[model samples]
Target chain A: MEHLPSEQSAAVRRIVAQHKERPGPLVEVLHAIQASFGYVPEGAVPVVAEELNLSRAEVHGVVTFYHYFRHTRPGAHTVSLCQAESCQSMGAEKLAEHARRRLGIDFHQTTADGRFSLEPIYCLGNCACSPAALIDGELHGRLTPEGFDELVAAKAKPAT
Target chain B: MTTTVYVPGDAGALSVGAGEVAAAISAEAKRRGVALDLVRNGSRGAYWLEPFVEVQTARERVAYGPVRAKDVPSLFAADFLKGGTHPLSLGLTDSIPWLRSQQRLTFERVGVIDPRSVADYVKHGGYRGLERALQLSGADIVQAVTASGLRGRGGAAFPTGIKWKTVLDQSAPQKYVTCNADEGDSGTFADRMLMEGDPLSLIEGMTIAGIAVGATQGYIYLRAEYPHAHAALKAAIAAAYQARYLGADVAGSGRRFDLEVRLGAGAYICGEETSMLESLEGKRGEVRVRPPLPAIKGLFGRPTIVNNVVTLTSVPWILAHGAEAYANYGMGKSRGTLPIQLAGNIRRGGLVERAFGLTLRELLYDIGGGTATGRPIRAVQIGGPLGAYVPPAHFDTALDYEALAAVGAMLGHGGLVVFDDTVDMARMARYAMEFCAIESCGKCTPCRIGSTRGVEVIDRILAGVDGERNVQLLEELCETMVQGSLCGLGGMAPFPVQSALKHFREDFRARV
Candidate 1:
């Protein structure tokens, strides 16, 4: 009875069509939807379910299960801090606290200015250089509180 | 001759300013009018020396590292292009003691070759295994793997050959070979390194598995946390398809095998094989019961061969070389080499691929160069978040599966995370439960509910509110999770907590 924005609906249909022939293609479809929109909009779920011949609950269950899927619109830049044991061994907890205070937002929260969003990642597979973080998909290792501030500040400045 | 330079595009290297170093070298070399060819290679598994740049000389590759962007001009002035001496130069990279002593079998071409080049991978003995497999029957291939004694490198230590044999024996219309590239374990990067370094080997390995198990379609369940690995795998897979190494008629064998890489969002439990298969099916990452194991009924109700990236990658070597060649290395039943990832608070943290007989002390001190802080080595959490906290007393124990298991520790994926004297045992113990609680897949009662209670018990013990009793309760809860949980996630999550209680009882007492 309801519909998404025409453009988003078309994109979702295109993604589902590409993967519909493959066995168990719903996850791949969801991944494509998220990649296009940065987050799976609430409007995209029902469209995906209908196109993929799955229930709405089935679609929503998967979206909520994994921590990586974003439900809300992210800020200009997304920052993910590794909160696993390896990072914790090298003071990742303190680093996380520092980032929270610096960004003025806790994990899973966006800044008021919409410049940054923070999330806690399990691992980035760069444990050799512990206390790692990903700012807009670029990983930074051996992250200290000071280095993190410098990185955030550097990114905040407007490009020439 | 154009001077060839290598700056690792390995994510670990890129993370610590290697990208900036590469840019500086490019700009500086252009200004100096030096003709240079820059090849973005993978890390040599030496974290301490990264942005470890190498220059090709007639003798060997000359290494200079921990190189910063500012150091690029000085490196150029010092005639590093000609392998001239510099303060940072380690001269003849292979001669470095850290990398020289280890046996790098699975990681043979990791830092040496261009990851996306099929020709480079082939020149370095890449598809020889698939070549050998095409000439043999599926039964014979399974027999060879079984004879090699190759076990699962995904922490389960299940016999890989037996898993393949099950899939081979099963009568299915559509069997599949699924590589568990979901390397979500903390303090482990061997899978990432291999994927980013020599992805062709993994592709070859999967092809061989498909040939053995009669599987035409394969899927690589890669974790999304490693966007760098994802990019490398995607590019390499395209190259493999172009070269006729992946799609139908692989290597002109007429036996079809198509491989695809599916990304897992951010679930840690999906590292488990059944959970991985469940996630692959577009479901919540809930663990399936194992009456009809994944070997029999997996991946869309067909027989499946689910293996770790290392295990499948190890297959090419086992097939290329004789089973005896692989079986000859290591101690006892744990045959072949393991890519041991030394991480966390270690001075020379990197990957050390060696036979399984090396002791924890040798790894921590000799290879790892002890704690990065130069303080006393207090504890080392072997495996990952699900592994045990090995004390200094057990440092003499061998790293083989049986040997480590004897000491109540499992060599789960060969990730050893070191800790210095400043570590808080109680807090570390609390974190183990907290991590379990956070990541538990909520299918069974013991795992989903027990983890939450275990955290509360640890908090109560730490608060000294009837500390001894709460500690006992924590132990009881750990036992329940171990015996009652459906999968290894809950079953082994209490290992660190139990080990902490067993060895660092004094720390808990002090906290109380």
Candidate 2:
């Protein structure tokens, strides 16, 4: 296993310690680690397993089973487009195609510029205004190709 | 005096730019020197009319809708604060036909009050059920729920009282009350709405359960998709703690009930009760075999009462109003009201909470205003991803659990995702299989393997490669999954495909 950076290892230890006392704290601990760092670093798995008194395979199995946890670092912004039945009825598939072409990335892939990572979310519970997308955790609905472009452009703008 | 304006902070409202509209209103208010008390409340579930702005006047709350940031200046110019007229104005908020027609027992305070304020919650009849529950014995509370005929609103339709009673009967000292807030269904948003709008009700409901079942701990297993709801629930739980509604001594009754919100990773199977329990235990969200129900032994090997967000949220209403009052509203078994979510390709998609007797036609056309695309209505997918699709012929079927079951459909989560005439049934059937393949927990072979086979068979049929044989194979595979699967994810995943084959078989025919 690759050696984790000193600070990243310390951060992982801190997150695990914060939630290790709860009834079932593995998922919560992982969430905190992901929240602190963009994704769960590969090196932190053994550390979490050792701290929680579980096998390294148990922690790794959990990380792979749930779709929410990420083993890799994502782009600067994450764009999750709804691909479920509700959004499908409102042209989500077409919108998804447009998103891919515009972003130059497919689902689960980061853009070449590392500005955006695209993901397919089943539902965001924003079905009322369908063809929804969550860009960097902010929900946007009634998204046309044009609307999606505008949102991407706005997010891509550099801070002054 | 400061004029009060209400804008929804609901995810649905925010998705359509309610946040921008709120900012614009505040900026405009500052510029005009108007004394404004702008409040970000929850959505009314009339999502078509969101950023559904309401202003509190002396008489009533005036309504204006679908407001954009650009419309703010014009709304101010029209003196909307004093019930002024504008093109977007829809008169009094309460008097709006769409909202006024339905019975909003569970959602009464959702769009009306500030979500985070416990004092505001108390003022609006929020804790009345908990207060009433505090006065009664656990058995009496359970009996009231049983008498109310309340069933699980999370697609299973299990009796809420029986689940509680089992936990109440358990001899275990460390029992739990887990609210399944993992609302992963495609068209469902009622759980999300209530949590965001009136989270105190859910907190109150869970507290009542904890007090009744002799459980001291509660956890809300929320989905990770709803960050807004997470924030709302966290804030509400804090306020409830600070206000003494949730702590070592809940509401000063000297009974202990501690509550916390635990987030679920993006696993659709976690919506299932057993899978949810496993997920809560910080493991893989695989479905557990029944006979050892969550009520008897669940959540770290203790008696646990697992109820949906809507089911738990509805408890407060049943306790506040008498059991008969709730039982009086619905048809036969499905008592009380259901917060029916109208979504997808519909003109007026939103949450419509009503008694259980209304026909799907009334909901789809009268309430939903038909398809948003102005095309003829084709099909409606009732329930979630695992639910069956109903054709236009069955649209008149009443929205009851048994009525829907009679028509080969289930009222799973009371979500109606409408589709227009342009929809291709064959493609939808394929998507169903695909979704199952993606979300199946791999606990059961029939679900894990059969779903993938189902998908491939559909693809072969669609490609015109011996269509008849492949279609037959697909049917056989579905049957295997239905009969052999351990949980609903595999069992009911075939419902949509089977329904499409039964109702719209021509969609499967290969075009030469």
Candidate 3:
């Protein structure tokens, strides 16, 4: 099963066992498999359908309902930065421009070297410290062009 | 230990270099041999009091007005720390009407506690709801939520209890609670504030949801926009797991609920429930036609209850205070408090959580103190981009969804963006179409190609493409997009366009 990758292959069996019992067992199973591998690979759709006793169309429909699921591998580091009014008020748009120019990537694209990936986050709750950005789940506040360079450099250095 | 911070917590504070102000506090304290303990707490929500540094002595935290780092030395010599009364002192920090008057429940612990400290969270009444939830049967927990009347705060005011009940009735062995933290509206920052200020409330709410619905897992569908909220959540989650509030066991209750935060790309459409599920599963964010609502079918085709950040965050308060305590506060059918975001050219821009019956006059005039420009306020757009444009004539309308809808507007997330006379309504109208066009997922034709053509039509109208004919064309396109679109991006995009055209017809005429 380790070689089987994610628990997605068991989705059909899992759903079938629980489908008659409840209406939304599908969302649960999908979340489980996705949590394990970071993304839900396609090979498990039929497994989900067979288990839930729902048509493939029905199962696919559920997977397509929300935007949280991922079918591909995300880069090593995901950088989600604020683009809301409060952040924009503090020149987040310009900071985003600097980020795009420096990282050589747009809002959602990963870099060629796979060193970092950028994601546009709406509000990081760090409005008190506006123009906030997160690198690999670590929050950085009061970001400027100079601050951005030092932080990105720190994130990219060898762990050892 | 002994330092002063005049944080306005208003967007204006950050705008006018409060960041440098914060840095200056650190450097100045080190140089002066004074101790500085700076906390980036939530906005006291007072805009006029911005860059307002407060000095904490033994007795009280004294208020200092709009002090620049350039004036720190003079402030020190003036014995401002001794509270000897400087020219800039605004008296007491908590005495300000904006800070003193709010009956903050959802935002109670925020800006006052360490966001990632589980101990601080528990000390501040964080996981009491989860503990209460574990003691009750799932049905009983659902009853508590139903009685609270907590509705989705991400635009739509759908009752959260009904959504949770649908998933609860589903007998699926697997279930999921998805928190939609993708707050993309232009003038809103409440979600980010809650996350950074008091993250544990959200975690506790999700945990309670998991126990109430028998779901073993939860996911926070955070937008790519908030890097700070994401980090705070991640650190808080790790702390929860270590403290046994999360992970396999869930604090010795043996309920076995685990949570993971999945980050979104820059897609705004994903904020929609179904589209959020698709993107969470790692696919392009496209709207799904609902027969299987996320309550019946969501996330990975399992029974999932998708809720907004406020919807989830408010759960702990409801469970702790009981349904009636919350239900008694609001005016009409709109039960409980709503977080109102004031932004743009407003005199006082910040977040205010209040009971649901405040009027636009009260919001803009009394609380917001009108527009900052000192110019005449032309229009106010409530509920973010999807909400209607309220001309000054309509400012007296109440804030309830039904009432707002009656006035051709909706109380969508209660984001009020103030625009002065200088704002070009025609340009704003055109930009609305452009935003929809760029952000549309292209799954359906009305939202996809229609938005692109919308840009062209608006541009043509601006360029004087047959006066009457162009206006007719614009109206026709808006109707099609509204009636035929698959999701909100297309369905609600016409609101701003139609509103601008209806109220400010002269602007369009001038462009033509």
Candidate 4:
């Protein structure tokens, strides 16, 4: 088992404590931990399991089950392209291919520079303007290959 | 006098650059020294015309849209703030032909008012249903819902009233009302729009459910994908709390109803009611076997009322107006209006809330204006990924529940994803199985294993490897999944594949 730093362990305990009173607080606690940390740290799983009085396997099973919860550190920005039927009708498959070629990475892969991570989201409820992509939680619809490139380029620039 | 300009804060509108357009309008107004009162309202469901801007004139709100940030300068020059003419102008928002044709019951105030304002919600006849529900006894409230002919809008088509009646009849000290806001259906956005546009309606509806079922607590099991909706719901909930429409003393009725939103972690299976309950309990989103329905033992083993966002949201309208009024709108078994979503390859794709008798021909061509790519529309997939695909022959099928079922289709959540001739039916079939394989919870065998096998069989057929035998094997596998799976996820996943095979047989021919 990986050992979490004392500070990280304390943060996990605090996150668990904040939501412990609520019924079925494990998911909420995990969300809080992931929000504070980029991903659910493996080392913190045992701590959460201890605080919630659940087994480590149970905690680990939950963390792995949900697609939203990441296991590794994410890049500076995450790009989620809609891959469902509506988006597919609007050429999302082609757009996905273009995204992969542009990012030089497939879905669920991060760029070597750690600038962007690409994910295939089932739907974002923005189907009216299909072939939608969420760039750092901001949605862009009717996205052409060029639009995708521009979005990536904008994110790539360093902050002033 | 300051001119009031309406800009949609709806997620659909924002996706098409409404946020940037609003900023441009603000900046342009300041530059021209024009006094402007910009209100961020919800989308009118005319997504083709979004970011659909409206200006309040003496007579009505004039519309202009598909507006870009660059068009802001030209709009200002034309004095669009005063309902001035512009190339993008669509005249009066109310009189727009596409929107004017439909019947909007649940979405009455969606694109009209600021979603965050409880006062605006009240002004538009929001809490009247809750007020009515407050006056009635629990059994009376249940009877009213039963009389309304309201079915579950979450694709189950279960009687909303019966579910409530069961929960009402249960003798439990702690019960709950759980709103399934996990709208994971690919082509659907009605739930999202309602949540973002008029969240107070949902909040009010849930409160009514709580009072009706003796459930003081409520939880909206919202999906994590909709960050916009999450923010909107949270803000609206806080406002409801402040106005005393929520907390222990809801609307001074001396009843307790507390509501909060819980985020689901991107599990499509969680959209399933039992799976959702499991996920809410901080576990893997595995399907729970029926016989003990969620209505009997749901959400922490309590006799719970589990309803869809639209179903719960519609409770206010039913309570506000008589049940007969709602019942009179739609056709035989399926009653009342459904918020239909037009998406995919369609030219004028958006939300259309209408009574259930409208045919697909009216939706696809008359309203949607045909395919966006100018190609012939080959097929239309209604009711999410699990729904059957209808070829052009069955385009005349009505949007009613039984009407669709008669033609081997179902109006699951009222989403229509149109596809043009360019679509490869073979690939789509494979994708259906693939989607099922990915989203299926491993608890069930036919769903978990059958889906993967179905995908492989389709792949082989596509690759020209014993195509005939592979197709047969795929059909058998789909049958097994349909008959054997514990829940809808596995059970209905084969509908699209079977429909595709039944309709477009030539697509499955050997590639070589």
Candidate 5:
């Protein structure tokens, strides 16, 4: 799958229009753009900076300050496992190693088939269950290798 | 008269399936053909015992918790149908040691009252600060805050009273009050908890600030990830407005204050006051330069009062009980309670609010009961990502903001992430820079590009590069990010990255 959906540009334009009135709304604008595009594409930065009356550097700085904003397109399926203290207590380190080995990709990179991307989530507030992962946006808790593989299998399986 | 049984409806409880818990109770009540009084209450901040259920009887509320929907059938069978004690029952909810131990000045009514009911907030000593604040001069209000010694709880422990004094003293016609609720710190969730459990407290806090600082409008820049909190806050704000607790001429006290909730696009950097202001104005969350502090020129280039959720939440307590009562809580110059988020490998993980003097050892062993894994804790990171990695050797150190700083660390946010024996300090140190690289606003060179290259340097060091040179290069890079970066995103990002490397040199050497 392409990192960004084909109509990503249209989404960026729509977000910029919604937040044009407020002063210094560059970050909000970028977030919407990124939401529409998955990552904040290099192409959208100039337009956002221009619309918000901010220098390009200033716009770029805000984007970089936050870890949530991705600059590249995610693979078809993205799995962010929590590594915060609580999640780690639940063996997130071991889980992360399992994920990396299975997917054959480190934190920020995509898999060869473009079927999945795995990343470390600092925390997703599922600490009580521990070893939580967000399969896309859904929270999955008490994860084992089998549970992870089951979820991965669904994402990996071809749709009819 | 409406009979109501309060159950904590905070997001944490909800995350652990509070919806199902609520459904079970309602279903049990209905099946037995019993008239019921159920009220979803805010979090009491006692997270360990969640889905904390309480039943309203003629006299007092009986509590039971750590409940599930599956347990409902058993509860029904046991005739807990009449608010009687069961195996899960913990007697009176207020008497629980964990609940009673907390200095719940801000969280006073959270887990006890109906969140959507405006009357509940008012009845529980809500808006009393705004009522009192309206009668005082702006300077007097600011002075009272200064007297309270309340510091910003969003990690930067700058005195909040001082910030208010500056903004109050500034002569600007247009000012904005911004609540930094974009709580992206991994191990911390106080902001989200406050918003979900007792949003009125935050609204009251912001309104009080508006009255004190001469601002009419406020915005809560909330993180997008907390959809439940956003819904709760939005509903609470609407209730406040309907009851005249917010909007123009609130409570007819002749003081005008209005607030709106703005969803942050999941950017951690926006937690910084300036970046928060930027995001609120509907832009990409970015750091702005100082000298033109938010007090004088912020949010549309107008003077602004930007405060963390905790700092402002304490306002009502300061005003109601007087600043001296609050100021008397803490040990040193850091004179106020801090809600330290205990997380990571810990058996007990939740918020612990106390005066600023508890040692890390006490927090770890006494409060936390050591690691959840039951292994010896090797290292602990106090504060969020940017915090220093503290070894057990510094176990005697106090939890004061200044004390932490004295030992080459700063308490950014009170997120203590513990790591056990199996952890690798070198790998942890490298991940910090990698996190910085991924999240660095790229505003400054040291953080933007430096973080990416910092990872490379760490890799080289790990792959048998000249150890001494690699260490020196890492140190030099940290200094640049510290001096050159615009905000805490880069300024403090090196603390965890560098401190782990500094204190755990053997770990890094072992990798090589």
Candidate 6:
């Protein structure tokens, strides 16, 4: 087992402590841990399981089951393209292809430069404006290949 | 006198350019020294007019839209703050033909109120239902809901009052009320809109439900994708708690109702009530078999009242108005207005809350203004991933549950996703199986294995490899999956594929 980072361990402990009183609070704990660290660290699972009084297998089972939880550290920004029906109707597939080629990474893979990670999202409830993507947390819709490129470039720029 | 300006903070509007428009309006107003209060209201369901900016006049809120950041200065120059006549100036917000003609009971206050404000929410008839619910007996409240003719708006047309009465009748010491806000349907945003736009109504509805069903604890299982809605809900929930509408001693009736928002981890199956219950319990969102319906045994094995956001939100209106008054709208057994979302390739993609009898043709041509591509509309997928691809030949079908079911289609979640002539039905058919394969919980053999085979068979037919045999095989596989699957995720997944084969078979055949 890997050693848990001090801050991550502390954050996980705080989250677990906060929600441990609520009935079936494992999911809430996981959400908080993920919020603290962009991804749920594998080492923290054992700690959470121990704190929540469940076996490590149970925690691992939940962590792996949901698509939203990431076992590893993600890139600086996660770009999720809507892969549902509405987005498909508005040329989402073509835009997704363009996104992959432009970023030099496939879905669920982070770019080597560590600026972005591409993922497929079912729907962001932005169906009215199709061809949608959620960059980090901000949603962009009616995206073209060119618009996507500009969006990524802008996000990649460091804050002054 | 200070002018009150309205800009939508709705996700759809924000996706376009509402944020920039709001900022520009603020900056221009500050630069020109115009006294004004900018309120970020929800969308009016007319997305074609978004970034729709409205100015509150004595008569009504005047509207302008598809507004850009650059258009702000020009709009001000045109004296838009005073409801001046500009090219984009749409006269009263409610007078818009698309919004005016429809019946909006559940969504009456959606775009009209400041979502985060408790004061604003109350000012617009928010807590009338909860107040009324507090006075009535638990059984009496359930009876009123029953008489209102309300059903589950979550694609499943199960009667809402019946579900509540079951829970109300349950002898369980620990009953719960759960709002299934996990709206993963591709073309549906009514749930999200309601939660974001008029969250207080949903809060009030849930509170009333807790009072009616004798349940103190409530959980809203929301999808992770809707961050904007999440923020709005959190803020509104806190405000609701502060105002004493939620939490212990709700409205000082000595009833304790505590509400929490639980996030679903990107699983479409979680939208399924049983699966949603499972997710809320901090497990994999696997569907639980029904015997003891959710009303009997659910959410920690309690008699839980599991309702969709729309179904629960409709409670406030039903309780506030008399049951007969609420039942006055709509036709046939489906006696209520449905918030039909016109999405996908439609020109005017937005939410349309109307009486449950509008024709598909009226929604498509008259309301939506045809396809966004301006091409001839070929098909429309009502409901989400599991819904059928309806052909134009059946456009005259009335928008009711039974009316749609008669035509081998469903009014699932009331989302009408339009598709232009450019669509290939074969590809769409493949996506149906693929979506099922990706989302199925693997508890059932037919759904777990059959969906994969369905995809492969569709591919073979698409590739023209013994196309005729594969098409027959695909149909057989769809039937098997439909009969053998555990839940709606697998059961209804075949609807799209079968509908495609039935309505658009030419697109299924090999290129010849």
Best by DockQ: 2
lDDT of each: 0.92, 0.94, 0.76, 0.93, 0.78, 0.91
Regions of candidate 4 where Cα sits further than 4 Å from its true position: none
Cα displacement (Å) at residue B466, model 2: 1.0
Q: Please write out the lDDT profile of model 4 over residues B148-266, one tens digit for every residue.
A: 99999999899999999998888887999999999999999999999999999999999999999999999999999999999999999999999999999999999999999999999
Residue B11 in candidate 4, Cα distance off native in Å: 1.1
Name the best candidate (by lDDT). 2
What DockQ class does candidate 5 belong to?
Answer: acceptable
By lDDT, is 1 or 4 better? Answer: 4
For model 3, the docking class works out as incorrect
Q: Tell me the TM-score for chain B of model 2.
A: 0.99
Task: Single out the weakest 10-residue window by summed lDDT for candidate 6 chain B.
Answer: B503-512
Cα deviation of B5 in candidate 5 (Å)? Answer: 4.3
CAPRI rating of model 6: high
TM-score of 4: 0.99
Worst 10 residues of 2 chain A by lDDT: A1-10
Give candidate 1's error at residue B237 in angstroms: 0.9
RMSD of 3: 7.5
lDDT, candidate 4, equals 0.93
Off by over 4 Å in 5: A1-80, A97-120, A125-129, A134-160, B1-6, B81-83
Candidate 5 TM-score to native: 0.87
lDDT of 6 by residue, B1-512 (tens): 78999899988889888999999999999999998999999988888788899999877899998899999999999999889988888899888888898889999998898999999988988899988988899999999999999999998989999999999998978889999998999999999889889988888988999999889899999999999989999999999889888888898888899998999898889999999999999987888988879899999999999899999999999999979888988999999789999999999889999888999999999999999999999999998999999999999999999999999999989998888999999999999999998988888988888988999999889788998889999999999988988899889999999999999999887765
Candidate structures ordered by lDDT, highest first: 2, 4, 1, 6, 5, 3
Writing each residue's lDDT as its tens digit, candidate 5 over B55-164 gives 77667777777777788777667656456667788787768776666676766776777878788888989888878888899999999999999889988888898888
The DockQ assigned to candidate 1 is 0.84
Per-residue error (Å), model 6, residue B313: 0.9
Off by over 4 Å in 3: A1-160, B1-19, B55-61, B65-67, B78-84, B510-512
